[model samples]
Target chain A: MSAFNTNNFSTNGYELPASVGASLKPEHFASILHTPPPLGFFEIHAENYLVAGGPFHHYLTQIRQNYPLSIHGVGLSLGGQNPPNLQHLTALKSLIDRYQPAVFSEHLAWSNHGNHFLNDLLPLAYNQQSLNRICAHIEQVQQFLGRQILLENPSTYVEFTQSTFTEAEFISALVERTGCGLLLDLNNLYVSCRNHNWEIQPYIRALPLAAVREIHLAGFHREIDPMGEALFIDSHDAQVDDAVWALYKSIIQQLGPIPTLIEWDNNLPPFSDLLAEVQLAQTILDAYNTLPAKAQP
Target chain B: MTFDAAWAHSLLNPDAELPADLRVWNHSDPAIRFAVYRNNVVASLIQALADSFPVINALVGDEFFNAMTAIYVRQHPPRSPVLAYYGADFADFLQDFPPAASVPYLADIGRLEYAVIQAFHAADMPSLTTQQVQGLLINTEKLAQLQLSLHPSLQTLQSSFAIGSLWFAHQGAGNIADVQPEIPEALWILRFQLAVEVLPMSAGDCQFLQALLKGQPLGAAAESVIEAEFDLIRCLNVLLQKELITHFHYL
Candidate 1:
């Protein structure tokens, strides 16, 4: 009954050129504007630019003019117990309209509960209740935005005892039900797999990879869990780990060059350093570009 | 409590029991694993406060600031997920925080820092052109009845302590030792072009601007400034030069 034809929504039409990009940081705004770097596109956290108007918008407006953008939302809390915040959703719609980004994405995890926004992506129980809640929320968001959004898999620390579906199965159902796409974050995959002792390849194979329109690569902090097993924290501070890069290479080899992004949020290095990481991902993407097209999953 | 409510409660309250439903792969104690989320929630909110109030953090040092913000984070977790405007109540928190009572000027600094952030993110609008301002200024009768609209970013703060000098001291523009914190100061903050500019304001100018901000007409605003040293020409000139006057219309 609504004006939007939600059934036709697909991320395939919104794919960025098969190349690499970096998270747009305020520190690197000047350099990015000084000379538009040789990157495919820049990804920005939607919450960072949710303000009315300022340097964030000022610089992003100019940068957006030159580069294809991916607006990544961190605050939607799609998996929360309640439905998505209508006010936040309205703000997101305005931002989407203003920017008209190539791809819009959000995490699968919930960051808010009740009146408090936890400020970190928290894990959710992948049971029927949560799945129903998340699917309904995503459907609302998609209908409100009138476009398909890619839900990035979260890097979580713990799992819930009540979980019925595996994380991959939960995500696959989300895509199937909401007609949403996946923003496959390799760093998160590595971190979650390492923390939970889940094998990486099986998890990847379980995901609805054909819905993946974008990929993210970031660094993680290594710590020890209470069980004395190695724990990886999804800290976006350091350079992308070599192991994550290996995972990314394999994913790209199979998927054949997705829009990969280098996300370095905290303790940001110079623009050159980020570009160096972008170059690394770009190297992998470029290598796959030359290969014969693989069969779509 | 529902699992979500219990988990949310435990995240902000350090001493609260962890949600009963949390689990790890090895069946090991989930306390440490769950602490990661608790730590992340508190530490990230604390970091947001520290980022917004760096001068306050520097004045209080890391250990004190972190500890104080931890309590504040628990007391007032952000209602919204946009961390950019998360610390709106931080200044008020510092005012009543017992540990920070030693630094009496700390709350004022928090206010200034918060104001700077507000000004930095306020809606962008073009300032009235010089010609347009002059065109209005020449009509004396019209000017008296005109209600001027300042830039959305313009903010004024009146502090009993020398917040402007203290802020400048932290910016390396002035010697910290030279700052006399006892002196009362009125500060004007606005984003001129891209940079947020902070300047010391005279008492009379502060009153006049505050009145103007409240939608008082030019003549009424000028009359409200009871300070003997209030120079109408000087304040008008500054407003014109700084492009703070965004628009004006006859009352």
Candidate 2:
């Protein structure tokens, strides 16, 4: 396996064939790999291909030759007090070396402590301490992988009273310190906003749009607590909610056509069904991309 | 305790108090908020265990399986972020677990399933080609020095019960209730073209393979099996046909 050279790809240089893609599913590997979907890219969870040899790596290697790849991780624990785990970091670095994904990204949350990894993207209190800890962690990760990564805004069901910075401010600070980019998750913005009765518009407005490189659109599930208070869950098990789609369209219109991913992790539908959703994102991206050069801001 | 420690403790133990440092934007009691995180953590780990040990889950119905996994996960949550490597100690844990005392074979079943899962992710190396293992001779000197190499994905599982039967029985094998506990069973678990195959072996074949696994040459292994009147040619044919022997050399 050869290392992916990040220098070869730039937003202004060689870009991904299509702006819209779906996270690669094992069920769709045969279809996508054999036919090689035109203008389609794939995103994968880095942990799934950590092993030395398996069907997962075989297919990913084959599919990678044609389409662009994005490596999304779930285990960085960037906001934890302890420094990032060296073993995990080494494995992630090996992956980056093996497959130079067009882009690499992880959550803006912590999922590890001491030696054990909790295996869930636990929420963090957005304060000065966490902001500093995460920036250092992201910098360490970037230095180790030899490339800057995009930190995504996480969806949470709760907030800390001790939080001194809003989620957007915290992300902005990390970007400023590390010179990293952002993978704006529109579904998360809507889910977190509705869960705490916060305004989505202001949160989106506060973000540094120029630093935004990719966008995530996914489905959500609704739940009502025992006390009859409504709560929305960011379960990527269904079609993208109409509300999240609306938010996504607005972000693209404001930020221009950034590469967007359609994440369907659970209750995965057929290949055609997932592609249909990808096409929907393609439609939105196409609408923004068609504006004349003189029609710029 | 620090915020992360307190937060992890609360999530691990549903009965634990909400961390004083933990708070929600809207309300004071954050118990419901805690529940959402707790649910995600517990449910996802249980799903991991079930996915790794589907045979165990099927042998014991979902209700009992879910109950067992729920207890097992809380007592021993994942220590690594890689969900693929989770539940390695489940078989050992089930042996001492009180609720599982009724089924002594349960531990062995779990052991078999864990191997199957591990074999799927084990390192890949090409098996020996046909030209490698040419012939089996009756001469003592020639056979004494030959050592067979197994593939990285090849593993042998020995259990006191018919775990292979129980495993297949769960996979639409009929009349499991009528089956009875029998002698020890040995299974050749390996990955064949992206699929895990569980091949049951007779006692003589298993002992011969076991001797081979211990780095013994063909003469010693053959002598042991020959004492039991095991057919050497037949065993070699099965092993050769399956491509289990990656390569062989004179010791």
Candidate 3:
């Protein structure tokens, strides 16, 4: 593990704000550090900050002072055939030890296979054996972090024929066995639903909603394959599509104010543009929170 | 082979047959669906290598870099998932890559970019001020045994070729055509956010840092400098001024 001053953990120097968050980006470092926007917290991809020193840690230390942090991992490869890489886990543990983010999460996909590591989040077949491995990996991650981490459902273009369980069923079972939380990336849900022709409502209902600790809202790329099928790739480059926004509305209406993260990793706009998206989420969350308890569905 | 291994293999080697039991929609072609993933896996990594070594990409142009990267990534997929520190072996790969061989110094540029990016991610430590440097030298005996701690983001590259000039030319500091190789150059890289600056150093100073980086004490490190014009006090001040030396601890 890299050396870090242990538990230098402190609050974002404010009473927690709203339940809407934005995935932190390097482009907004100066602006966010100078004047933090009103959001519950910021989520970071754990792999981005795995360096030993320099401006990343320097600015993060300062910005983290005002916003609660959520460290998300894309490299954990939780569903890989081999055990999750210990070095990746160690780097994650060090970041967690230093910052103590409010929510720590990683995708359910596996990127590393054999000796080679792929940068993309590749899908895995959902079978009992795969389930056993993923559960074990999630347990290992939580043990290292000493905190509950939410496992995110990945955006996949294809499905495996031999898999017995649905994605929702698989994630729900992992949550049950490991006591891990769920980060329902609504955009991923939308993309996978379209690609596989699965309905969003039933999948969302089948998921262990109570265990959900956060929601990810990102945009996707839509293209027609050679077979003339619409393939919704979770590209996270464009604006949140209308279909995704509708799904997000339905989800928040049901879930009610879970920490919603607006993730824009590629083709990033100015900080103000991201803020505009965050504000939209904040508005929906505010409206939901204001609804009478009995009226909320 | 396990199903996961088959799927993973199919990505890099398109000829690797997919496991027969693999699932996809019956109507959609499995090959193309799988190809989407293969494209994503390859493209994002190429993008990552591009991000890490942009100057190299600028020098080679996107068309050449992309072609070189496509082959390089297939042969040498990253061993770890920390994408920021990915492409550690690209420099070595370039040294052997036939297409990149025409620009032999391109690999050195790759190496320099890797060092710069790695240093950028290094942990932050407060560099010592001039007063702190003076305070450590209470006496020659004490100074002789002092092992100076270099700043976390400070990295030096000593190349037999003109790495600094080529790099400076790429960053708009000098004309690429004006660069002419003379002596072996030591390039210094330091980071502050998106900004990274590379400074050319005398061979003697590079030797001095190389020794200090290996945890050598001051008196012995100074003696290791091979250049005849090496000045101990002046080299120490250059390091101090550049915020390279974090602290000096006596052994």
Candidate 4:
């Protein structure tokens, strides 16, 4: 076992209150540093900062001092056939210790198999066998980090014929068994429901909504399947779609304010554009914040 | 084969049959939906390579680069999930790629680009100041036996082609037409604070620096390149200016 005792490490009391944030992009480092925006927190892909040290660490160190951070791991392969990688866990623990992020999350998808890491979030069969494997992985990760991790729902293109449990059932089971939280990605919920023809509201209601600790909203690309049915790609390139925003508003109204992040990864626009999206989310959050306590969830 | 092994195999190999027990709600051809994952896996890896080797992408047009990296991606999928260090073997791959034979310098450029990325992400260490260096130089006898530690971000690449000029050309600092590819060049790459700087160096200075990086004492490294016109003061000046030397101790 590693020598890191999570009890001894202090997270500096940084808390990500219910508000809006944005993905911390390298391009916007200058703007973020010069004029810090009124954001609840900032989220970063854990793999990007896995290196020993560099500007990624340098800037993140400075930026983290002012903002509550959320480290999202895209490479843990939580749903893979094998257990999580030990070295990756060690690195992740060190990063958490260094930055003391308020929250850490990963996907319910698998990206590694054998010796190859496919870089894309691949779908998994939601069966008893797979569920057991994922539960063990999540338990190991939580034990190693000494904190619960939020598993984000994946935006997958295909479904497995072998899956016995619905996506919501599988996620709910994982949350119940492992004592983990849910990172409700509204864009993913919208995209997966459209792709798989699953009912959106029912799917959201089916999930253990009370366990949702954070939310993600991003834009996706549109495509057509062979049957001429619409398919949405979670591309994270454009502005959040109107439909997704409506879904987010509905969720916020029901669940009250949650830590929301505007994720724009590729074809990045100026910092102001991301701030605009942040402002959009903040408006909805602020609206909910001002609501009477009795009216809130 | 197990489902994971089968699925992984099919993702990298287009011809491999899609893993059994895959479907969509429509039950239409799953191949079309499966193609999305295939495309994502291959295209994202190719994009990672393109991100790391932009000069290589520019040298060979996007069409050629994409096609070439497609082949490389299938042959060498990333072993680690860190996409930044995905193309460590790309330079060697380009060396033997028959289609890229016309551009012999492409492989060298790939190596240079990779080094730049490595330096960009290397560990941060406090560099020695000029005053500290001057203080060391004052003790001539002690300096000869002193072993200097270079900054964690310093990288030295010696190439037969004008790699430094070619890289700069792509960055809009110079014209590509003015680059004499056949002219030999040695490159010094290091990150000062936040920005990564790539500069050309003489062969003699490069050898001396390389020797110093290999833990050679200051006097011996300087002596090894003396016949190559290695100017100790000029080399020290550049090192001090760039804050490359991080620590020094007498052997």
Candidate 5:
């Protein structure tokens, strides 16, 4: 019943990122903003700026004037059984109203359980019950915010046994039912595929291309088993791997270029490293734009 | 419960029996993904707590912090998404923790740390001027009944142990044992301009502020402090200079 029509938006090739720089501290954020690369938009974890009239808010306002913004939320626990927190929704709505970010997104998994807040993205069962629940939660959020939200697929160490629907199927169903867009994190696809011993190509191919409005590329850590089976960690602390970049190329080649963000959260390097990754992403995005007519979307 | 709500219940408690109409019950791999979520939810909360209460974590060590956080997470999950304010109840959790009981001061330390964090994020506002204070004293006799408003982010705490010393030490100052803990300490945490700062207050100063905070006018609050060896003039100057007292109301 909301007026957030996703498929009919002006596609006229919205500005695609060549690459984007990322930072956690406000001083570093200000410094990065002043010397922004071609893809100038900066993304921030929404939880960091939830405060009112503080230094963080002050710096964000200063930065907002110069660059396009994206609010990537780590909370909201959309897949949990509990209804979305009305207070949290109100807070997010307040942020959206203030920033008017180019994109607003949260993960498919739940972070809070019952009355407890876990502060991490938990996995959800991909079943009809979950599908309906997530759809309803998404509907409530969209209706309340009065705008469409892009839901990102979560990185996982395990898959739910009760999931009747495949990851792609669950995503497509969500787009169909709630009209929410997808934020495909190519690194997450690679991470999930490598962990679950699945083929990444089919998983990427199965995504609802038209619904994907944003792309996320981040680094992952690897944990090896006694048998040398590698478990990829979705730790956003390092550089984007070559395999993930390859997947990004593959995704852009088919789905067309999307607004991309390069996330680096832990063991954060100096601004140059993040800017370099953003540049790397932009280079790939540009390559897709100039791909031979046969390869272009 | 509806299928969606039932699924939610199961996600929070893995031991909960699956609802009959739950969509995941018909899935080929429901438990696998369920386990992934279970791991994520628990791990994420544990990390948030660790991040917020670094001193508590450092005092207990990483292994201990992780285990204690797991128990704390299960017992006290955050009710709001504003994680900066999420661990407000953690101090209480430590007081009741059986393992933490050995370190009786742990709870009070958590309280002090929580207060500092609260003060750090409190709103920004200008304070009352000295001229305004002088004007306010025109009705000096009614000062006892006058209530003084404190900053939104200001937090005043009193503890029996050397919790204040322990906290300051953990903040790269010095060791807590180095500061003798024979006497109880009253502490004030406030944002003076841009940074949040913590300092110990004398018993008289503490009593004075607490009384004023409780709606007592300056006359009555100063009397309480005078009995406790506080220099009324000096305290008033400090309060005014620090911009702690925002407004005064005479009852």
Candidate 6:
């Protein structure tokens, strides 16, 4: 598959078709591809397309041929207490072999414990034990797939008091141990920073920039408690907020342009709206390309 | 706690004490952030359970289903991030789930749905053709030691309630009362093309497939069916059409 190029799309930018502002169903996905965005790629959750021979799998396979696809996995609890699931690993490996995604990624969070499976990307303890477990899991996964996998940072709600290391340090350790690249979800960083009351700049800067390969920007809904405490939910139900877009711009400025994807899963707008989001990212990337090196720092 | 271990430790258990960074959230800013994560964690999980077991959700209604999922979510929290494989133990949970007892058939429905999902994701393999089976079965007496291969997408579930009828009724077919109880159904669930099909099995067919699944030789499998009801030809025909019995290999 060709590497995604932002300049490939129609010069005239995209707009949401009047008919589909509320939702984009399976039927709508086919037409949406024809009105392609400048950024010639799409990222889909791997689990959503795991079926024997259904429409989900059918559409994914059809669209995958045309687009520079990336499979973002939400499951594969890489930081779990137990070893990486061989069956799950085998299944994932099969998918990678089949699709040949430009980037294959899973979260740093643990979702399963043993027999029980937590559907959410639950946080993992950042002590030596957890770090060791995550590294081991990543190594096992990389070995099984015979390829490097990108690990995305999750949007966490709460932090444990027992944690002995910073999130960036933990991720850096994993990269060092497993040689896996990073899929920096800027929106997650912003949400996590606000939730943890940490400075976002230091956290972003602390990342092992050389290992960073891809970027994700998703929309979030705001939630508050009775105490008036704020949480930016990574709901992916709306358009990329201005704050998130700003973060994306900063990451691009620092890291140079990367393969960026706009994730709008639930509460989806029309095909044109998705293309517009891609156009916005492309515009930012184009601006970075023209900037002088000395002028940027 | 150091910054590195902060988020990792928080994810292990929901009630784990918050780290300094996480706990230091300002009332105005952090609450929304925390609520966002918390709500997504709960809602997405609940939604996954609802998706996998649509019948359970439909039977219980939205309010009760949401409530049941909340309690289930807290008690048997997901250990994996994959929601498709999340609710494996939900059937067992329903047995002790107090509110769900009113809908006694809920657990069986969950089991059937789980089986269907398992069949759908099972490894890909080709079924034995009629000609291939015939070539092997030419030596009928030798069939006693022949091990039969089954389709990867084949699943069999035996339920006392009219689960097949009940499951069918909920498929936007018609009213629940219109479903006749008939006899208990040992469903032969198979995924052909894109659809997961649940076909009601006769007593003999169920026994024969159950025997074959146990790795019994063809002779034993057939004997088990003949003992239940001597309809060997009819059972073989059904198995052939469903493409369940893949091959009869000599052991």
- Each candidate structure's TM-score, on Cα atoms with residue i matched to residue i, is 0.97, 0.92, 0.92, 0.96, 0.84, 0.76
Expressed as tens digits, the lDDT of each residue in A86-175 for candidate 5 is 988898989888888877888998766556566667566688988998999998888787777889987875565577888888898888
Report, to 2 decimal places, the DockQ of model 4.
0.82
Model 6 Cα lDDT, one tens digit per residue, A111-174: 6645555466767568898888888888788777776778998888777656888999898888
User: Which segments of candidate 3 are over 4 A away from where they belong?
Assistant: A1-18, B129-131, B137-146, B181-184, B191-196, B249-251
Model 4: per-residue lDDT, tens digit, A1-297?
Answer: 222222232334665779898999888887889999888899999999998778899999999988989999999999988899998899899999888888899999998888889898989999998999999999899889988788999998888878999999999988888878899999999999999999998999899898898999999999988788878999999999999999999999998889999999999988888899999999999999899889986
Please identify which of the two predictions, 1 or 4, would achieve the higher TM-score against the true structure.
1
Ranking by TM-score: 1, 4, 2, 3, 5, 6
i-RMS for every candidate (Å) is 1.1, 1.8, 1.9, 1.0, 5.8, 5.2
Clashing pairs in 2: A3-A97, A4-A100
Model 6 agreement with the true structure over B1-251: per-residue lDDT tens digits: 64324433443345655435444344444333444445655787788788788888887899999988887886777654455567889998987898777776678888988887777666555678768877766987786888987877777787766778888888976678976554566778887655678887766777777888889887878876753544667656666776666656787
What lDDT score belongs to each candidate, Candidate 1 first? 0.88, 0.81, 0.81, 0.89, 0.74, 0.71
In model 2, how large is the Cα lDDT of residue A234?
85
Model 1: lDDT to the true structure: 0.88
Highest lDDT against the true fold, candidate: 4
Which stretch of 10 consecutive residues in model 2 chain A shows the poorest summed lDDT? A1-10
Worst 10 residues of 4 chain A by lDDT: A1-10
How well is each residue in A1-297 modelled by candidate 3, as lDDT tens digits? 211122122333422244888888888888887787877788888888887766777788888888788888888889888888888788888887888788778889988877678888888788898999888888777767676777898899888876899999998888888888788898999889888888788998889998787888988987876678778788888778888788777778887778888999999988888888888888888888889989887
Error of 3 at A26 (Å): 1.2
Better of 3 and 6 by TM-score: 3
Candidate 1 chain B: worst-modelled 10 consecutive residues by lDDT = B227-236
Q: lDDT of candidate 5?
A: 0.74
Tell me the spans in candidate 4 whose CA falls farther than 4 Å from its real position.
Answer: A1-12, B129-131
lDDT, candidate 1, at B78: 96
Ranking by lDDT: 4, 1, 2, 3, 5, 6
Better of 2 and 6 by DockQ: 2
